[model samples]
Target chain A: MSIETDIKQKKFRSPYQRLALNLIYTSNWIQYQQVDGFREHDITSQQYNVLRILRGQYPSPIKVSDIAERMLDKNSNTSRLIDKLLAKKLVDRKSCPNDRRAVDVVITEAGLELLKKLDPVVDEWDNNMNAITHEEADLISSLLDKIRESKNNN
Target chain B: MSIETDIKQKKFRSPYQRLALNLIYTSNWIQYQQVDGFREHDITSQQYNVLRILRGQYPSPIKVSDIAERMLDKNSNTSRLIDKLLAKKLVDRKSCPNDRRAVDVVITEAGLELLKKLDPVVDEWDNNMNAITHEEADLISSLLDKIRESKNNN
Candidate 1:
């Protein structure tokens, strides 16, 4: 659906305004799919993301800051999110040998198993999102990067 | 910057995955700017959005459900968001004369003044996002809408 129909708004101040709204709205729409997929696993989408990041470095423990740096949502508190994983026993945390000030996080076997189950589901979601072709996806990705070109930190 | 550098990921399963990740990351980037702007005004972005929707219907009253329908984030609690606006005296709330069970919300002059103050700041942010040309913005918007085409609802 068009953003105008989605938001029930007839006009935008400029193309920039429409693009801005579309970005946020589209993100929310995609996020809902992720959130729903993880609901059955008793984890928030952020938690699922954290688990996947940890699984990516399964054999080696990762520093909390390093995890935060790689997160899609950079604002999440790694320590707090790790704490949730710890409570669920899906991840193990330990003092870093290299830096005592830092914590080393490793995904537990349970986390790996959970992700193993979720992998196919995630693949299916991505397949559904293939409504647009690879060329279109590449074009969109390039344009999005261009959209953030003016920002210093992005 | 490319999504790879932004998230420090070496590879994606497919172009679709890259586009999905890029959509979310860029939204977070844009939302942070909105959050910061509304922060100085002592309202969250969602609250700012609600106030703007109300102001757009200045002379008339709208229902809580109506406001939710127009919100960028569909999960926002309309009554709760309206309560925050009411606390600041930016809006007025009362029982709807047409439907005694429904509440009517109207933006006060204060809300209009607040939006006036915010208008220029929003414009500047949109201007900052003009890293792409108007044609690029239009293309991105259309592509984003196409990305959601496979879904039954967006």
Candidate 2:
């Protein structure tokens, strides 16, 4: 799965260039797999992420802003995802007890049950990350953090 | 910039889970920066990628599917992106000589010139990938390849 072999591109300006492209490509590759698994349960990754976050704070409602902050895709439309989940009856929405315009969101029992069924598939994909050793996984994550630490050129 | 601090989350089921999320998150972060730079030049990443691909095939007309196959994001609507670049007068599209319905696509002078201007910014981003050593870039790319080599559970 070298970038060349994976994408069928024969040349890159440099290893760094290939790595930059490969990082984006591989992430999309991994994403499609996760999307396929999540699709079986009728949810997008964003919705599943929100559901999981709510479940983590189970029995205690969390603010929509809090969920947005914790999401992997910071630009994801939290309200849209929430609306979808609510339509599916997988999540609950209610006016905050303390603030009229604020909302308290939580995973419904159905959402928890859905995730319980999805746990094995999700767990399997997580295990697939072992395609590289634990040490390599740690190394990749650290390197990615370093990549982001580079000053924003804007 | 550690995962915990970046995402403000204290727990991950394992390093692999963190790596999976980090891969996608960092890719998105890098993309935004690239998008910002490309925007300064009046192009999106997808358009830039198309231009680069067309430049690679300079002096030769390429089919739309060929461009699609070479794209980093396989799901990109290359025809649509081509439409945008075409509207900007950056790419030339014509009916393939041999096939009436098939179109031949090539980067116009304007497109190549645009890329020439973007080269410095793109190069800077590639250099930014050097936030890690060349050895680390290779390592991360190889590890990412391995990450995708895992069996598709479906």
What tens digits encode model 2's per-residue C-alpha lDDT throughout A45-85?
A: 88988988898899999888889988888899999999999
Q: Alpha carbon lDDT of residue A81, candidate 2?
A: 92
DockQ of 2: 0.76
Q: What are the TM values for chain B, all candidates?
A: 0.95, 0.93
Query: Which sections of candidate 2 miss by over 4 Å?
Result: A99-101, A152-154, B99-101, B152-154
lDDT minimum window of 10 residues, candidate 1 chain B: B145-154
lDDT of 1 by residue, B80-145 (tens): 888899999999999998899989999999999999999999988888877788998998898888
**Interface quality of candidate 1 as DockQ:** 0.80
Q: Poorest 10 consecutive residues of model 2 chain A by lDDT?
A: A145-154
CA-lDDT, candidates in order:
0.88, 0.86
Best by TM-score: 1
